[model samples]
Target: MARSQKQKSVTPTPPSQLDRFDEANSARLGLICVQERIPEDYTRWDIEFLVDDRPSRLTCISPGEYGGVPHGLDGDFATILNVMYLEQGAPESGIVHTTAYQMLQRAGFPDSGQYYQSLQESLDRLKAATYTASESWRDHKRQRWTTVKFNIIERITAETQDGLGFGSGTTLKIQLARPVVESIREKYLKPLDMSFVLSLKRSLTRSLYRVLDAHRYQPSMTAEAAAEFRINLQQWARECKLRETVPARIKRNLESAHKELVERGYLTSVEYEGSRADTVIIYTFGDLPATTPAPEPVIEVVPDAPVTDALRRYGVAPTVARNLVSEFGESLVTQRLEKFEAMLKSGYQARKKSALLVDIIRDQGGKYADPEGYQVEPQRSEANLQAATVAKRMEAEEAQLNHRLQEEFRLLDHSEQAARALTQVRMFVGREVSERTLKTLLSAMTSEQVEPYEVYRAVTRAASELRLADFAHELRYAYGD
Candidate 1:
């Protein structure tokens, strides 16, 4: 049996056709192969399959020129098979054809026939499939994260031997939850502490940017985070008993810094709030000026100084002196004072004349009317009646002229007619037309003109209608030449 035993024919298993295809395709196309479980929030389109122990995932998509499907028909089929294998990584002992068909469908090729298409068509279809699926998955993830919520909790406690209020304590204990503390320490506290301090130095170096910027120097980067920083710093300071007085060295440094800030225009002044010997220096960036110039003094001329002085001193009403001065100038005030004492002694009506004079000044037209010549009672009555008559007559004339000119101009189209109508309007209003008035008249003239004489006639008619014959004559004399 040993002599007759021939060499057993050993058959080597063939390399996976799909694997070979994927390698060719990878070489043909420069696509990266990745393997990761599609996130739950992602759509099915974004899901990709990978071969075990391989960096390349068999994407149902084409790759770069040298990485994916090769240049020919066999190469294209190899690429399709690679995609299928990626779709289903498990090998089938005999179910290879059925598995291939299923993968082809998933990769957007309906059947085996469609899977073995021309290289360009297959690549185009695969690219479209991959892009569409990836986009859908990305959108799904975005929507999912939009609804995600992160929760945080912070527990702050204060322990005081003196039993001060909530915020006031000698010893403070703060316990933050793990997640919240991690987040705060990672995203806010550490970065803010380092960055904010750096930012402060840079800003100071830049001269605080502006006076207002320096005034608003409280950290606005992260308000809550900055508040936490300040609270912690204060607590540390209190524990170290750094309040009431900073270390002498620190104080000297701060003083020097403040002086430099003032010189650089970053700060305006330094103030001390504590006792004279041990003062707390406070720096102000911008403060309003301390003193403003007083307004210039008014120089008032007072006539009859002695009398005016006495009147002012004795509390005599200023209205009386003002009235006397207004009525008889400076001399009247002196004369009034001379007679004032006599009038007061004789009881000869000291205030009666002053009252009459004040009343006369208050009445319209009384200032021009001679008080001694015009009898106040009759003159006021006659003037009222005359004014009423003149106003009524003028109103009637204005109404008549406006009505006549409106009727006449409504029937005319000449520029001169329009000018005349405007002139009539002016006359009705009782204003004299001048060189400026004539220019305005010409502006009102329309561009259309059949004849210049027609314009003259229209102006003449309008002047006659408005009873502004004098204005018409002036216009003729000016323009006729």
Candidate 2:
């Protein structure tokens, strides 16, 4: 029979069969080879195949080819075809050709007319002739491998783009059950060492109480005993080489802890039944260790002579004088006595002078009588008596002139004070004043002025009347006007 046109176009192609067999066999073999080498865990694998002297397991597949392979033919079609084969597969034969073209287009490969179409057509033809072998055995063998591969790929993509990886670079996401986070913080995050020390300190008080209750020691702990305990604790801290001071925060904590334990009825007082010296020793230790020696008592002695003198001079009671003598030494007592004597002597002299002056004035007429005494004369006639009186009056006037001259020198001191006040006011206020104001202010001051209180008052009043009180007050009080 002659060759039919249909037979020519679709021949019984043996080469196509051989090509399909070879491709399927190769794919199956590749899977088996890689399965043994690849790790089951995602963490162990690399994204790309490892390079070696042997043929590489991975084959690159272009989006323009191998698009028609059945899903069952590979565990992951894109990975198997695109990453395994170089897009060189059998020729197109049926509807698989059109499907392959669509897959390539979906994969973002350009549809550049005939060249891409021809490649898809070849891949489709290969798929048609390829035996549809059962993938069940391979799937069973490489199920773990396939999972690892998928995970690895996912991790690699996340790591390169999102910074997820192993070691310090790895990011962890934690999800705590409700209330667990707070519980964990409360149980663990508190200062454990401080708590431990506090507990130990509390236990120490209990131990001490047991000793006291058993009558193992002496009387109730005294202030000295407490001080000793503090000192010992400080020494312990020092010996331990602690960074903090013993008298500081640590000691405070210990004291608080001890007090708390005592309040909680963990300690009891023990009575001392011994001699006076032994009793003193017993109370000194309390429940603390009796290691440090007691400090010696300090006694001060004072003499009685100076104290007695001070009492008489200052009008202090005898009992008070004795107490002061006992409390302070003789030197301080003597110094105070001398000061009191000096003050009393000065006061007495002032009073005596005043009394004498008062007596002299009283003898004259109970007032400050004129220095000259009045005189009367019985002369030959009234004219003669009058002349004698006039002569006496002239002598009195001359005596009065001498007294006035002596008093004038005393007034000079006050005049200087008034002058200083005027100068101060002028310098501070810096205002021009009339001569009348100056004279009026000076006239009010004492003739023998020591301090310028009157002068200051006069100037202050004049400033107020002048309507410059604010400025003048500032000058007087603040600027020394």
Q: After superposition, how far is residue 418 of candidate 1 from its true place, in Å?
A: 54
- Backbone clash total, candidate 2: 8
lDDT of 2 by residue, 1-481 (tens): 0111221222111111211111112222222111111122211111122112222232222222334322211222222232111121111110011123233332223334442444333333233322211221112212211111111011111111123222211111212211112112121111111111113222233223222221221111111223122123333222222223434443443354346434433322212333322222121223233343222211111113434554644445444555565555444444434433444455534345423332332242434222233222234224343456546765765465435433432454565556545544543343444444444445544444334544444454565467455655543443243
- Backbone clashes in model 2, listed as residue pairs: 59-84, 60-85, 90-122, 90-126, 91-122, 91-125, 92-121, 92-125
Ten-residue stretch with the least lDDT total in model 1: 144-153
TM-score of 2: 0.12
Query: How far is each candidate from the true structure, as Cα RMSD in Å?
Result: 42.7, 53.2
Identify the runs in model 1 with alpha carbons over 4 angstroms from their true place: 1-268, 272-307, 347-481
**Candidate with the greatest TM-score versus the true structure:** 1
Tens digits of lDDT, candidate 1, 1-481: 0111121121111111101112111221222221111122221121222222222222233334323321122222223333332222212110112222222322223333334233223333233323211211111212211111111112323333233422111122222223222222121111101111112222122221221121222222111111011112222222121222343443442354355445544356755544433444444543222221111211111123344455544345554644444554443344334444444455444356545333433444524333233233443334243456546765765565446445544655565365444433333322344545555455536544334334445554665577566655665465433
Per-model TM-score versus the true fold:
0.15, 0.12
